[model samples]
Target: MTAAVRPPYRVGIVGCGAISRNHLEAFAALPEAVVVAVCDVDADRARSTAERWGIEHAYGSVEELLAAGVDVVSVCTPHPTHEAVVLASAAAGAHVLCEKPIATDLAAAERMVAACDAAGVRLGVLFQRRFWPAAQRLRAAVDDGTLGRPILGHASVLLHREPEYFSSAAWRGTWASDGGGVLMTQAIHYIDLLQWLMGEAVEVHGHIGTFRHAIEVEDSATAVLKFASGAMATLSASTAASPSLGISIRITGETGATAELSEFPEGTDGRVTIWARGGAIESEQVHPADVDPNVDLAAINGQLIPHHTAQVRDFVSALSANDGTGREPAITGSDATAALRILLAVYESSRTGSPVRLNQTATQEALA
Candidate 1:
């Protein structure tokens, strides 16, 4: 007997917002995937996106998109509404690739994971920065002990968001919808990568404030993280800066080895410096960030498309096997949940002016 051949995977995208363009572009570049349908609360937006992308179908709601059927669904909706869309997609027998933050709260994040697990479909998050070349190299060094016994780590995210940026979207800059502020929305990529390269966060102490933006959430925030591996790290994120410093992360090990990486605005170019004990530290520019500012779509796509495409490829590959052997996705629901746990702690710490300790459990209590 021979195994049946699988058909090309069908993809449906929920929420036709600006971020959806990157998802569409990434999927369009992959032959294994097809964008059959798209849905947004705005019917006109969905119709326009469907026409622009040459998608086969367009719907006004996620319900309609799910009913039409797709092998994989990308939840591009707001951070708060991700849980509902993910639950429905998983129940519909579709694997899900959700955008960052996972959900507004830990309970909702837990529920999304449970629903997908019960449905027996794969779930992945859109933390594309993990796929960056410099990031990958650093991760390899950490795993291989090139950076022996990680002891210290730090990551900073400074981005400029005009008042109109948040005010334009009613959901933005709200605890109920956008989650926390810069930490949850803008800096989550670095936060996820920091935890990924360093280790799990066991304790967090931080402070938050809405310095620039007149929104409810904190535009400027900072946190200190203590990893389970005994590594101490600090995080700072702000949308209040005049010029975006992009993301800067540095990890120092007990052996005096260090990895420093930074990315600039609009995803132009980044520098990586790696130093191993007893050897000359070498640095080089990676990930071509040289992009035109005026050409917004091209610039965004230039950097995002490749990274997003890489993640999508990994997700598709994970879907190809059921042996439960070596096909695990690079980023899973549990991983995203863990990242959300840290963000929640940062918020809780800021709210209460104390440190929050995470118990040794996969589903740790984050909201308390």
Candidate 2:
């Protein structure tokens, strides 16, 4: 007789913060899963989220949850602590879905990936923009050769923030933990998008500086990139811009197909447009973001929330198939390594007043 199928999957959450809420919503919506545990240094924060989510298990430390029973763990903690959490969870035999940047440093990012490999667990970093509908349309255009090879693509995330945001979070503006100010924390989505569209960058030259906020990392940065395809791109990110901040990426293919996302897919209440040659293309492919009500204004933030659920689902799928295994690690922990490598190069170039070269994907072993 065939064995009965198990229900969805079980999940445990680490960190309780602005982004964790979105992860919770995604977990709640899935029929195949249960949020079996919650962890946070703040007892109240962890317990409160557990109570609200109807989860009976709550722990003050992620180490405790690892000791408890958890099939998977979400590393939604502070930027500085991601590496440790992911490694510990991977060691505990739980696949992990870590937030972006993987870690504050390229080294930490590599360690997380390597540890996962040694532990035989998958590590998935969140880069939800890959699933955006408008993004899909653009990707289609590029793939179809409508953009004529995309000679260049440009993307930027510029948002204004009050000073309070910098000082409010204990580690917000510091170099040791918060990583780079805006580029690492806020605009990383666009940075990942740039790589997604243009392929890995071969070299980069940039200008980085801090202003408008009291952060050790650059509040602003701009760079010129040379891709393996011989294509070029201009990338910029900042958190000090005035209000009415814009999030967009314009790609110019050798064939002259241009794709533009004027509004941030996360909170875009406006329409997205695709222009080719000189005419506007009809139809917007973006689906409803499907964000959870738990997050304010899910209509906008829904994209991230919804995609993360899909991300977790992918995580579970991979775990289920090991050794000819379930799903080959959906998004390898190494993807984060690549992104972080480029980010560090950008910073290095900005710091040295020189350009950095990245002719190929950085291997985890090379990093080792």
Candidate 3:
């Protein structure tokens, strides 16, 4: 393959908010990126964030931002607006970096993907947790067969939210805006990791309930995932836990080699807490901070961004190089469809009391 030309990347922001700050910071860290414009439905919020970030223009809609001459966009809007913004971005000839839970359903996700594919623009989803250093090492090990055949894994998040949290926003728990409560919004990171490591889940059986928070959706969820590779996984996620808890993931293999990863506050930003046994590093132990987690808007070469920055780089590279790999490793719009499919299956299985197959089409209540 021939090397692609390199230059500073011009970027735009759509739906500026808390998570959007991370995107702004990551982009700022990259010398190749210049964040010039932003768009949001709430003009005040857009104006406020744009001013704070020193962005030159604030757009009232996705179309306006596209007209501002941006090369790519970071989508931080609610789940419901994902398709609209992504399609607009593609049509505008700008690449996209969308937030998690791509869309509420597989159909919307497929539409977003198809739009980008037809436009010949790249669509990247933000799964920044993958950039964690320890995760990199662990995944590398798994890919190299050092962990032997994968058996099963467990991922859980002990996070909590108050009753006021649900009341804080109209879309907080609604199936329309935020998608499917804890599973789609918060546990998605863990879900992505589970799929990333163990491969696609062939079946999902879940038990869901609203144990604490009063919302339009389930506050707690536990699922059993059976992968095509015969590897199994159990996911436990809740917004009802006390004192907010971090995330933990454990991967067990047939060779007795096991790897465990975790997240902690004030630490482990781009790193994974690791534990391995009965393998090459059985006797060795490492901390997540050993690799250092940086969300502080710092790029390696002052020319590339960190965290979601990789997605941005891949987007630009894909546009300029026509390299298929540029878009593959990054999350495509359609990939979110697959994630939504699994989530909907879990919900369906929980409600109907049966194992839901991945190949099965989503039922109408899949949205509810």
Candidate 4:
């Protein structure tokens, strides 16, 4: 007797918003995955999206889609709604791929991770930049001790957001909906990369304020982080800049090893520079011929599709390797929570006007 051949993983998307289009495009590019269904609160939107994507089924609710039996569910809904959908998907015995900032609230994020654990399903989060070649090389250097004794790191995510940017989306700049302004929504990808490159943030001293935008959340924020590896980092994020500076990051070590990268909209390509001992330096300028030099915000997805598709392929491969023996995905639910924990700590520090410590108990003394 021969073993049975498993079919490609079936994926159902729960939101038909703008970001879902990126997810749909990524799925379409992969042969190991299929967009079996799509769901949205708006029936017309769901049907239209399904028609546009050539998907077979469209539903007005996640329940209907889950009943249709998808092997994986992509939760592209609002940030606050992720917990409920993830819980439901886990209950249905389907793996979940959640968007960034897993949940708006810490308690909710904890519950979502726990529920997935109990239900025995894999949860992968979309932090696509980690799959970038430059980021991988930097991480490898840090892990292999090439960047010995991490000393300092600087990460900046500066972009421009007009009034229409916030007014266009109901949850664009709200703490309750989008989590936080520049740090949570815009700079999160870099924040995740920073933490992954350095180590866990053990202490955070931060401040946040809405300087330019009229929205409820802060449009600009800054933080100083102390990592578990004894590394110190400074981070700044703002959306008030006139032109998008893209992401700039530099990590320096005590042994003359440095890794720096810069990405700007005006530049033809993003650049990464790495240097180690003995005066040897290497750099790569990544300018894909297909991407334009003046890539607009909407068109940015065209450049990111490869990274997103790579993540999806990794997720599908992880699922295939799971022979009912509880193997973890490349990016697990807890792994996604790591960055969220630091961001939450930053918010807490800003609110209390004091430094915040994470994953550790501190001795408190009563004021005289």
lDDT of each: 0.82, 0.74, 0.74, 0.79
In the range 273-299, model 4's lDDT, one tens digit per residue, is 445455877765533455443445566
Give lDDT tens digits, candidate 1, residues 73-106: 9999999889999999988888899998899788
Q: What lDDT does candidate 3 reach at residue 367?
A: 19
Where does model 3 exceed 4 Å of error?
1-6, 270-274, 279-306, 317-320, 323-329, 360-368
TM, every model: 0.91, 0.87, 0.85, 0.90
User: Which wins on TM-score, candidate 2 or candidate 3?
Assistant: 2
Our tally of clashes for model 2 stands at 9
* lDDT tens per residue, model 2, 306-360: 6676666666656656544255545567777777777777888988999898758
Q: Which candidate is the best by TM-score?
A: 1
- The weakest ten consecutive residues by lDDT in model 4 span 359-368
lDDT pick, better of 1 and 3? 1
Cα-based lDDT at residue 238, candidate 3: 87
